[model samples]
Target: MGIIKKIFNKSRSPEDGIFFEEMRKILGFNPVDLSHYRKGFTHRSSNKTDENGNPINYERLEFLGDAMLGSVIAAHLFKEVPTGDEGYLTKMRSKIVSREHLNELGRDLNLIKWVESKVSAQHFGENIHGNLFEAFVGAIYLDRGFTYCEKFINKKVIVPYVDIPKLEGKVISYKSLVIEWCQKEKKQFHYDVFEDNGNEDVKHFGVRLKIDGKIVAKARATSKKKAEEKASQRAYFAFQEKINKK
Candidate 1:
């Protein structure tokens, strides 16, 4: 009986056994160090700390992961679009790693379901999905090195969604595009932004986009930047023909 109990003890650890299986499904391979992956899902609200009193959360890992993703994407773009200039390559990479795209990827993987947080997940902002996704990438790099990191990204990100021709016309930032077009066409453009507090829980900002001293578009959003972008997008559509000609 003692020998039987000893054999049972040597089997899968109860603490991380199920988690290991779930991670295997996501990663397509068994992870050697589960701690890294745990950290990837840890939230700052947990108030965890390392032995050295440093904060133990996914923020640092998110930074590393962002860099890794960018590097890998840049490399792939470089090889795939040999004729693409530096500016063109940069724009393509930005579209691939945009916050919106990252959020979509995270939601598709349902990564937020694994987060260990003291706060309720509903209280978390939309960016949490993208942040967790980046931290996961960071953890993969630390656990299995660059080769595996590249493989995972290529399988999950590049192969599935990165279509060069489609991405070439993708507008990651309408605000930037509008500004570029205005500069090239020598048009005088101004964004008249003001606080537009209404009967809402959150304060909002309104923006009126004027091109060549004429009101092209007006919009309101929760923040100034968002309001400006919203106005710019409307303005872009309004002047799409002229802008496209340029």
Candidate 2:
């Protein structure tokens, strides 16, 4: 048998009673159709196709969950912050649905314990937590419909974590702030990123944030996006006083 098939078999071998009970506790209600919930936790690596030969995994569900999260959060923000303009509302929504926030939520729920993947958990990046959380939301939407979906989100996300005052000050992306600052001030900026893998076991990327040909900050991380963001953070601090004054 294929390695993926073997992994799928192992993943499916868990007791339905135990899994259902665990899901019930997390869901705060009994699930109707268990298959949708199962699909939410299923990873693409399982190589399991449905009776219709459709690829079964959490990815498509993730898309739905993302949209659901945005809309729900947007509505809450709209009702809560009536004075907030479009840009303010948009920024607030971004902060609330930020990947970091979602990852934190997933961790709080201990959602990763149920994932079925051929790849080991440790091998999975931090984003896996957020992705699983989203897929789970999608599953809730599918299994119970939008009313239940909204309730679950409110219970898990809004009531516990949504603090309007706190979210307003949160910076989802320092890189975005830095870029916006540069453009508003009509300054030329660049992120010179390159592979920084050396003798280390893991690959890395290095970035230098330059403003008008002057290196303002430098950073290195596992990915180019992270490296640039880190460098931008440093640069933001370097110009914090000036940026803030503007």
Candidate 3:
């Protein structure tokens, strides 16, 4: 039986064996469905499809992983912060699963090294890390079920970083903070966003944050939302003393 098992293992592809070992090291367990994980790391640009003609990529898995992360975080927050109202718990959960936090987790795990993409990895944006992380979570959930999914998230996310006190003070959205401060101060504020005619492959949006008809901050990013947020963040720092007093 031992010899037979050894021979069976020898018949497996070397690349698959290495991938399985690496996945075991990262996931803390052997994966049942390696295909799911492969799909998780697959970029849509690869243009892969299953036998039935359905697309095979990480996007669907990313969606599932997002939901799973939210569910686990929400449950944990509900139990840990019994005094927290629904609004408070929801906000806390959002902070835990924010894109920034997710990107950090993915980068720490070095998940991008395993991604299968037609485009160069360097060309991919920052959000790719977070997207792959979510897809990996979805693959885990699909391969091992909810219990394993919860364990994985707890080990990687909650146990290491979900400190209630720290999270309470964490700023998930600088844009929201600036908007709230403006409303409280009864100051008129607006984000004037426009397409930036930059010589780049990707389109960029430029944003000028106006507070009381004065341009307080200007910033640019790949998206209008990001541009506005960047401008808002700069504005917050510029007016930190005044805003914090409120």
True-structure lDDT of candidate 1: 0.86
What is the clash tally of candidate 1? 0
Residue-level lDDT tens digits of model 3 in 20-138: 88888889876776888999999999999999999999999999999999999999999999999999998999889999999978876779988898999888999998999999999
Worst 10 residues of 2 by lDDT: 4-13
Model 1 segments more than 4 A misplaced: 1-11, 170-246
- Tell me the lDDT of candidate 2: 0.83
Error of 1 at 66 (Å): 0.4
| Best TM-score among the predictions, by candidate number | 3
- TM-scores vs. true structure, each candidate: 0.65, 0.63, 0.65
lDDT of 3 at 199: 55
- In order, the Cα lDDT scores of the candidates are 0.86, 0.83, 0.86
| Deviation from native of the Cα of residue 214 in model 3, angstroms | 53
Model 2 lDDT tens row, 1-246: 453453244444358767777788888886666788788889899998989999999999999999888899998889999999999999989988999999978876778888888988988889988999999999988877888888899998997668665567666778899899899989999999999886543568999989999999999876798788778777876787776889
For each candidate, C-alpha RMSD in Å?
12.0, 12.3, 11.1
lDDT of 1 at 29: 72
